[model samples]
Target: AQSVTQPDARVTVSEGASLQLRCKYSYSGTPYLFWYVQYPRQGLQLLLKYYSGDPVVQGVNGFEAEFSKSNSSFHLRKASVHWSDSAVYFCVLSGNNYAQGLTFGLGTRVSVFP
Candidate 1:
């Protein structure tokens, strides 16, 4: 079984500051990892995903994530954040079985202060 863990339940950062959200996964084999963001009263949007190839992948709105197989972690990072970036971010893990569905972390709520 695959599972994800986001140690931080809440994160706060000043506008224009860099940010990193930690994510850890537990899976026996290579698993699909994804970061999704949910805005206030809106559906979740895909921030980035990693399955193979390069460890680093660029996402929308200056977001990016690095996958580390050795550490069993996929952490999301942003060079600089804006106040509008405030939202809830979820770390998800998916195995080969689609029917089993994806396992999601509790989520990290980010608050960007001006």
Candidate 2:
């Protein structure tokens, strides 16, 4: 089975500060990776996703993620954060097809301070 782990349960960053969220995934075969952010009262928004092409993919709102096959990691980064960026980020993993459904990490809560 595929699994994702988000080490940090919560992260606090100041406005305009660079942010990085760690995500480690375990899968027997090539997998699809995604990062979703959920605001206080909104649905999950797709931040970025990786399937096969580039190692690094750009996401919305200055967010980007890099997939490392050797390291089994897909880490998310932002050059600068804003107060409105505060939300819960989820690391999602899926098999080649969606037969097994998606595996999600516990989710990391981000708090951006002004």
Error of 1 at 37 (Å): 0.1
Best by TM-score: 1
Ten-residue region with minimum lDDT total, candidate 2: 94-103
Give per-residue CA lDDT, model 1, range 4-102, as digits (tens). 999999999999999999999999988999999999999999999998999999999999999999999999999999999999999999998889899
Roughly what TM-score does model 2 have, to 2 decimal places?
0.96
lDDT of 1: 0.96
For model 1, the run of ten residues with the poorest summed lDDT: 94-103
Off by over 4 Å in 1: none
Listed per model in order, the count of residue pairs whose N, CA or C atoms clash below 3 Å is: 0, 0
What's the lDDT for all of these models? 0.96, 0.96
